[model samples]
Target: MDPPPPPQPPQFSLIPPSQIPPPQQNSNPNIQPDSIPNWDQNPNLTHYLDLSVPKKRRRGRSQRNSALFRSPLTLNASSNNDLSSYAITSSSSSAAVAPPVSFSSIRNPPPSLTQSSSAYDFSDEIIMINKEPKTEAMIALSAGFPADSLSEEEIETGVIPVIGGIEQDKTPTEPSKPGVIIIGAGLAGLAAARQLMRFGFKVTVLEGRKRAGGRVYTKKMEVGSRVGAVAELGGSVLTGTLGNPLGIVARQLGDVLHKVRDKCPLYSVDGKPVNPDMDMKVESAFNRLLDKASRLRQLMGEVSVDVSLGAALETFRQVYKDAVNDEEMKLFNWHLANLEYANAGLISHLSLAFWDQDDPYDMGGDHCFLPGGNGKLVQALAENVPIFYEKTVHTIRYGSDGVQVIAGSQVFEGDMALCTVPLGVLKKGSIKFIPELPQRKLDGIRRLGFGLLNKLCHSCWWSPVDCFSGR
Candidate 1:
């Protein structure tokens, strides 16, 4: 038997050298014979020696055992059955080398590795490695199995491993756009919803009332021969035309505006018209007093005790009371009532210093009335908006994840919530907040007052002459 080939020199490698073919010869004339040996053809030998070759291994569980003897730190299996196939040398030695193993492929291991019948399952072993603190040996073993290979349950529980002092995170694909919940489908809320929708956000508006226009109600009534006359119940006039948002919307809607004439006839409670000359004198005096109050406020700056506008006007009125009769005094009182009406607050409650703070930003130009009433503007804004009427949102719970609004029997959830409810509603504590509103906001809501005005529309057939003749 030729002395059994000298006992094969005690082959230390698991793979026999007889099975590994010789390095193929280069066909190109320019290639030197001394060039680096192509170890890809001899994977068994390369794996045994733990050689760092440029070429990658084939993709499959069959090739997993090819690197079984790569390092002592690497997990091992008792069975060598799977290793026998790779041990058999490649028949086509001149085949092109495979590409290098991608990081993604390493992260997402082959499915067959989990279904292996070996004594040791690499999937379980990888979980065990992740549980233990990262060490040099564990990292060396973890190189073959990445953290992403773990199941979703393990990943959610944070069983990922840290390699080279850097913890690897499974970066999932980005989620879809966020959705917003809007409370109170008022002008502010509707406007915000439209803006957010334009920016690719999903919006839902919840209105407590059956109709969208909060506090803006318009009704049709018969006036003399006219069948349908527009009667404004709230916010009748658009205060200004220039730089007014409502004016802009009106223009966009192609609606005509009737400019209110600057002619207002003053009458006493008894129906007798006041003398124009006396009205002008009282009005001029009232305006002078307001200008004087403004100058006094500028000189005083801030005061410890807040003074009401009524108190200042009353002091000036006392000086003028001696120069006027009861009728002129009534005109003066009427002017004060007008101021209260304009501010929607009593003169006694109006702050003397900060009451006119918003005056500088007041829109300029003629105050006009929309033909169909302000309700048309509300209808335009409500157009195409996803509004849930009569939602009656009562509770708002907000957190890091998102917001939850409890409206009547329904609970609405969204990525964020916008609260545009009226100040009166907030002050009344009609809606309950989960953690309660901030103290600062609560204080402001308490300090700020709200008022309402009732409009009574009367249709009269009598002319101006008939009214003066008591008809």
Candidate 2:
């Protein structure tokens, strides 16, 4: 027996990026009871989340070499606006040149995170992480490779030879603060940087992508000479606006928030709308499934064996067969498929045993979507921080002293580091770690899986429909 085809992952409806479904268009003025809306060749229909294929892994030296290189770079911080850093590359042992590279720019900045005049202030109390807790000022622990790994010859000649006037006087000032280095400028990384900055810690963010936002992306439409429509290519909705941090930020930014709900108009293949009776049946099945999923315990005092939703759904079918007819079941299946979007994976991967173990957050409010995509939130949070674009981190070395990050051709050192790279990237092993990670951490990294969700945006169109004709 071919091991009964692997359980298919749950499927989610491909909603247009804006969650704005085009209304059915009909030529007939007087619509018939069975008249279905024609969606064939609809130009306005957009495919929001296209999970047709798996995501491709990042390529280049980071994926291949995965080696660590420590180079001393020059930082010109005299003028905040003209602050730029450069890395030197040597051709032959004879000579090389250091190209001027603009690391980051500080434009008209946002309000400070706190009452402090600037975001780079040090407090009396020292904050340390992941080592013997010490209370003092700044400190830098050396983070070089194992002594045995480096040859004596290589060690003696490791200093990057400067071909230009790039060297600056190593003037000793008040020992600088122990800074933080954040890899990946995605939402999570940006959020961490923002919080750390608010706490008066220096932070430098390295982003592989040109833009700041990672998963949160927005695409703008343009007409012949002017901009037209706008839609989100990633992260469309905020599940609950109330008590949601992102929602709060959106509201503060003066972005229009549209309230959305679970209810949506349903039509059959021929455009015939599902009758109220059938709709009720679909809703009942969905509710029952939710109830069953919530009941994590088995009969009496035994623990329930966790199974995929597909498996438990079969049990539901036996119990509620009478209430759900074939037609209704089809509609229910359509609704159930939407779970894929929420979970970002197949139902088989979801565990019924600990589904809701992490105290889910639901404030009983309408789902909201920011008219201006989530990229705005990313931009807002990335203010005042130095972010190096197109810096793909290849390896990280952390120890009692601090952390050193090597990305592309640049090297960054900091007091601590926050690795916000997606699990997919981590699983690909694109990055190497010095001294290696613990077995348990490695196991967790391998065990957990990441999913892919893509979005496509198109023009928006709308038409009206009436579902009461059958009644």
Candidate 3:
């Protein structure tokens, strides 16, 4: 019978031979009975078969199914040793079947290890393969995985993955330069902005008023046929030409400066011209009294109680008052009023200790006036600088993270903030600080005095002869 069908190979099964069900007989006439192994004959034969040798290759339908469900054996030594240690146990089954392996399961192994037959022995290779795909955290935790292997959900939520108990931020660092917010578009603020911009910083200036120049205001006067002359309603004169900031700006703009002469024509309160000789004598006496007061302050040294400059000057004036006539005394009083005007405050409020402290730093040379008002200098400095006007910043919230300035309904954020607002504004509490200013600063602001100066510009057409003569 076809040479005894070449000894049909025995089928392997985990189940015992007695419990295994017999195979169904093939009904096809073309198939010979000798080709199929009879399970009834010698049932215990499969028990004695060697399992160490790999299963024989099959053909046709069985081969195709085996290829699809076959689990791959890792060629590592540890994996081979672990596989060899596994004990072969029999179950109530016809043939040995391997679990199906998926592509993802092979690529990303499970985190847990499989236990071998021996107690306390664990297999290094992950055998508990999941049917479903691996998750993002599992893939990231796997060794040799790329750093950017974050899931779509993690990326969208900006969640950084934790590896080995340490969280890592994979986002790239920002390359842009820092930004600065400057309050008040005054000269100080504008100058700082320009300098910062040159150094590659982004700057924004917030100004409360409609125009710049801060307290330096210039107004054009056109009063009936007088050639439109510009009047300085605020700061007008450049105190010194040598080393003066405004002087430098004037030179840059190619503008001319007018020097003011030290000539004063005194007039009595009764509208009578005073003798120039008497005017000179009183002025000298007043200056001598001021020098004497300064010397006295130096001699007295530091005192616990502070006295007003006016009080000290008055004390010195009594000694000199006996030598001058009443008209000359009136001229001296006028000089005192001029001194108050220069200080921009009443002599009663001026501090005796620090009233003339800044005199030594005064720029030497001629005191000059800019012809078109100092507003031109402001314009020159403000060129190309982005200034937001009427942005009255009412609140400032600053911290290590940066600063937030709230101007009306608009909010501005920057890496740093510069406050160039006048001390008067701070003292008035117009702009509220998130954390209130320090007690010391508040005390100083309260102690310091701010004075107001009012100017009245007159447009008069009269001849010098008529003006000087009692008109």
TM values, all candidates: 0.58, 0.58, 0.57
Q: Please give the ranking of all candidate structures by lDDT, highest first, separated by commas.
A: 1, 3, 2
Q: Alpha carbon lDDT of residue 212, candidate 2?
A: 86
> Candidate 1 residues 1-471, lDDT tens each?
455542121111121223222224223233233332222333222211112221111111111222321211112222332111111111222222222333222222233322222321233333344454331122212233233233232222221223224543332233235889999877788767665664467789999999887776666555555534566776677665643566655655557777766767888778999899998888778877775455444333354026666766666555455226767877777777667656677777767666654442344456678876777888877876789998999999998989999998899999999999989899889999988889998999998876667566665444321111011
RMSD of 1: 37.5
Model 2, residue 375: distance off in Å is 2.6
What ranges in model 2 sit over 4 Å off? 1-176, 296-302, 322-325, 460-471
In candidate 3, stretches whose alpha carbon ends up further than 4 angstroms from where it belongs are: 1-176, 222-227, 322-325, 458-471
1 versus 2: better lDDT goes to: 1
Model 2, 133-166: lDDT tens per residue? 2211011011111211222222221221111244
TM-score, cand. 3 vs. native:
0.57
- Candidate 3 residue lDDT tens string, 92-170: 2211222333324433222221111111101111121121123222221221112122334222222222323544333
The better-scoring model by TM-score among 1 and 3 is 1
Estimate every model's Cα lDDT from 0 to 1: 0.54, 0.48, 0.52
Best by TM-score: 1
